[model samples]
Target: MKQARLHFYAELKDFIAPNGQNKTIVHNFKHRTSIKDVIESYNVPHPEIDLIIVNNVSVDFNYIVQNSDDIHVHPANASIKQINIAPLRHLSPQVSGEPRFVVDVNLGRLARYLRLLGFDSLYCNNFDDKTIAEISSITQRIVLTRDRKLLHRKIINHGYFVRVETPKIQVREVLARFNMYSFFKPLTRCTFCNGKLKQTEKQNIAQRLKPLTKKHYEKFLVCSDCNHIYWQGSHSIRVARLIREFSKTDSPLS
Candidate 1:
């Protein structure tokens, strides 16, 4: 039987069985198998994989594993540096354009912070894993979750496992992860409905707001969908300061 040896690097190692790191596993095969199928067979999603080197040569997902091949897999989230003469060193494109996100139920606070940054972040506690996965694929939005398993799911092509535990930390973590700090557009989107905010005359919404709110806050933005009201209140100031502070730090994703 034809056979090949496999090695996983960095975070890819975390998915391996006990004592799997740096340990070679000999896989015997009858016919050619795609590198993707071989890796996913071991539970690694193809999108999360950044590079694969086989027998000292780089290859993409379509590369067929041959007899006696030595394969090394690297995760997209890893920060490793390697010199390579292999052809498979291509990286997935860096995330560009306006940042958008969809958060799992566990990340409601992070959702709010992303909204505060004026990003279009969708969040609903009612969405099941299947719904979240579907929304992510259809919208091409990045999935934010604390559930590592969700990120590991085969159908989820764009997802990130937020490592931070606290809401504030998670906010910073996401900003750093996406390099979105410099792109922050404060109070640009409706926090309640993920709609773009539009400036409205204070008199137009006078009856909708509390008397005190109408009296003190003359500037207003209203959601086109839910008609929710927003102002640059004290909370907005605090959020802005926090985002500014995070922007100053060296991003972890960099």
Candidate 2:
């Protein structure tokens, strides 16, 4: 069996097995192999990779693997000064102005969290990768997902790999990555429907409100798209607490 030497740098190492991490990894290969396939075989998604080097020379994903090759895989956000070589498909610049997203089904909770934070997040439980890819390209929404393969779609211009599994931590991961915490507008959007929340008179939506809600809450934000009403009720207290906790948690800026 022919063999190649490999190493993954920075957060890219998170995708591989423990044995393959933090050091040179030896991979045995048969027949011809592309660098992309070889890297994905180790479970690292191609879109998350910034650069690949073989035998100390920069190469692209389609570069065919050769026996006795020395490979280096760097994270998508690696500093050019660090590697002195650009990674293929550089993680696109975070779009200026408001950030929008087309999220995959597996990240439903993260989608809602992003919506609550006032980002325009569009997520459907049945969204296929092709639809997500098209929507991302046309609407310029960032593709947020745990699925590495979705980000690998060639049509995608801006996308992110949500590294954390927990919803709260995932929210933090996104905020820190895009520097979006400064823009959070709590309850400004409908968390369920992803529609702009509008201010409404208590009497207007009173028919839909519970007696307790009508009696207790004065101000409300109604969803223009879904007509869902939001108020600073008990849930708001919990939401506020969660926001405070996230703000206080030490997040590593990506």
Candidate 3:
């Protein structure tokens, strides 16, 4: 077996085994092994890697490991000057128009929060890993999951391994990672069904509203798919506050 040394930089270190953290790792491998497989062997998902340098030269994922070669892996959002390096291959897809997502089964709350901000977040609690991967591949939707293994699928071109566990913090993490603060359009989507919301006249839906709702609110928004009515009731304050919080604390991309 041949041996090479790899150093994972920045947040990429978090994915590696504890003994290898913040240091160079001596990896023993076969002669023709690709760098992509080597990196994933350490639990660093390819989607999270932005650049790889082999012996001071930037290399792509398919670069074969050479015995005694030195490799450096950098995460997405890492600050690196690109003057002399090979063109960095950003693993994340070039998303045009509004960004869309297919959330994993366990990230239902994250999906709802994303939808609340008017982003197209498709989610179902019963979505198996294969189903989510298929949807992401077909729709070009970014996959959001806490499961690192799901991002390893070859068909998933755009995906993220969500590190934060709390839904509120997880949404902020995603916004920061994707630079999506400018895309916020609160209340323009149905949090329940990921449907677009359309303004509906109060008189048209008067029969559905409670007496107090009819008396107090003049404007309403209805989900195009689910037909769920929304008005600026007591919940609006909490929604507004949450929006403000998300806008302010996007945090830096890790």
Candidate 4:
């Protein structure tokens, strides 16, 4: 049997088995295969990987594995000092405008949280993988998904496999990853449909508001797409607190 030793570094280890973490993984195979296939077999999606070194030589995903090969895989956030490394496959796309995203169906809460912070996040509970991939490919929208396999599609150039499960922490994770602290525009978007919120005259929506809401709140914002109204009610306190919590610096990746 042909054998290769592989080591996954940093956050890339999250996809591998617990027993194989922080150490060498011995992969046994009878025939040669591309490095991409071998790594995906361990469940680490290609989008999460930035660098691969084979037997001390930099190589791309298409590099075919050889018998007795030694492979080292690094995540996108790895701090490698080598300038001569092979060009990475997952280069951050040069987005021309504000970063938009098409989230997976399983990450609906995360999508809502992102929209709450005014990011253009497209999410539908019924959206399938093909639909998400197509949107991402055509619009250059980044894909946020928990399913690693969803990112393996060849059409997906910009995507991230959300590591954390909690919606709040996942928001912080995404902001930290993308350096999006400056992009925070809380309460400027409709959390329900990911539409921009526009300031509307109180009398324009007076009939839609309840008696207490009409009397108590004079200023309001309405969704341009859905016409849903938003106001600074008591719930705003909790939202502010959550925003403050998300604004703090999260711990570094392993």
Candidate 5:
């Protein structure tokens, strides 16, 4: 029987056995298996892997395991580059343009911040775990969650485990992780309903707003589905400032 050594780096290590901390696993096999399959067999998804190295050369998911080979796997958000493994599969490509996100119920604040940044972030406090998993799988939307177990779901292809606890930190963490500082599109989506906002004459929504709002704010946007009104209130400026602060941070994953 031939044996190989495997080492998972960064968040990839989260799936390894408790005793496997920063350590390599030795597995004996009679036939070769693709690196992707081996990794997924251990519960890590293909979408979360950014780099792989085998025997000191960059490799991809398709690389076949060989006897005595040393395999290293890195997560998409790790702050490292360059590994010694043959390139068998290229780095996984990120979703182009503004990446759409689906946040678990626990991440309501993060969802709001993502919306403030003009990303299509879908959030529902009432969604069950199964529903979230199904949405993530069917839409190919990136799943953002504080629950590590959610990201571990078998059906989820795109997912991220949020490490930050504070809402502000979480916003920065996501921005840095997705390299989305330059993609900010403010006020494009309804923060309340996750619906696209449409430009409307202030007079159209006069009755819906407070008496002061109707008289003071000229620019207005209304949700097509929920009819929620949005304006450049003091609250909007604060949210925008928070986004600007995050935009200055270096994206750890990019």
Candidate 6:
């Protein structure tokens, strides 16, 4: 067996086993093993990895592990200096501009929360893994999910595993990871159907509003797809608080 030293940086350490955090791990391997396999074998999933440096040079996941190789791993979203290493496949064709996301079956609430914050989030609880992968590849949407297996798929190039359970925390996590504060446009989309919202005259949606809603509100936004109506009412303050909290917190990328 051949042996090499592995070092994980930033949030990637969270996936490191209890006794192994922050230390160079000497791993024994046989045959020709890809760095992707080696990393995942040590519990860091490929999707969470952005850049890998073998020796002093940067390399992608497919670089084969060699005896005595010193591997330095960086998180996909870590705030670090630009390096010459080729990013893992999932990091491209470059994460600039406003990024769209595809939420998996378990993240319907997260998908809604993301939409509430103006990110273009697509979601369907019925979307199987294959469908989600296809959509992400075709539309170049980043796949967001709580499932590590989904992120492991070869078809998925851009993806993230949401670490937290609460929807608000997850929102902060995503915002921080993607550096999406500039794109945040609260209440721009229908939280229920992932549809764009248009300002509709009160009278146009008058029949749809409840007596209290019609009595109190002068204007509304209607969903383009389902015509769901929105008004600033009881939940407005909560939404405002969420925006404030996310604006201030530099949530961890894990």
lDDT ranking from best candidate downward: 3, 4, 6, 2, 5, 1
Q: 33-63, model 2: which lDDT tens digit per residue?
A: 8888888887777667767878767887789
C-alpha displacement of 223 in model 4, angstroms? 0.9
Q: Residue 232 deviation, candidate 2, in Å?
A: 2.1
lDDT of 4 by residue, 88-172 (tens): 4443455555778999999898999888888999999999999999999998899999998899887888889888977777888
| lDDT (Cα atoms) of all candidates against the true structure | 0.77, 0.82, 0.86, 0.86, 0.78, 0.83
Candidate 1 lDDT over 1-254, as tens digits, reads: 99889988876765677766668888888987988788877766665678788877778878888889999888775655563464457644356787778899999978987887788899988988888988988888888987766765656777877766888778887777677766888777777778888999988988888878877888998888788988878787776667676566754312
Ranking by TM-score: 3, 4, 6, 2, 1, 5
In candidate 4, list every pair of residues with a backbone clash: none
Once fitted onto the true fold, the runs of candidate 5 whose alpha carbons sit more than 4 angstroms away are 1-4, 14-20, 25-46, 51-69, 77-87, 91-93, 250-254
- Model 2 misplacement above 4 A: 1-3, 30-32, 85-98, 152-157, 249-254
Q: List the residue pairs that clash in candidate 2.
A: 50-87, 51-87
Q: Highest TM-score: which candidate?
A: 3
Candidate 5 C-alpha lDDT tens digits along 26-143: 8778876887777777766666788887877777767888889888888875666454334445565567777888899999988987787788889999988889999989998999
TM-scores, one per candidate: 0.79, 0.82, 0.91, 0.89, 0.77, 0.85
Residue pair clashes in candidate 5: 56-84, 56-85, 57-84, 57-85, 57-86, 58-85, 58-86, 58-87, 60-88, 60-89
Clash count (model 2, backbone only): 2
lDDT of model 3 at position 76: 77
lDDT at residue 137 of model 6 (Cα atoms): 87
Best of the two (3, 6) by TM-score:
3
Instruction: Please estimate how well model 6 matches the true structure, expressed as its whole-model Cα lDDT.
Output: 0.83
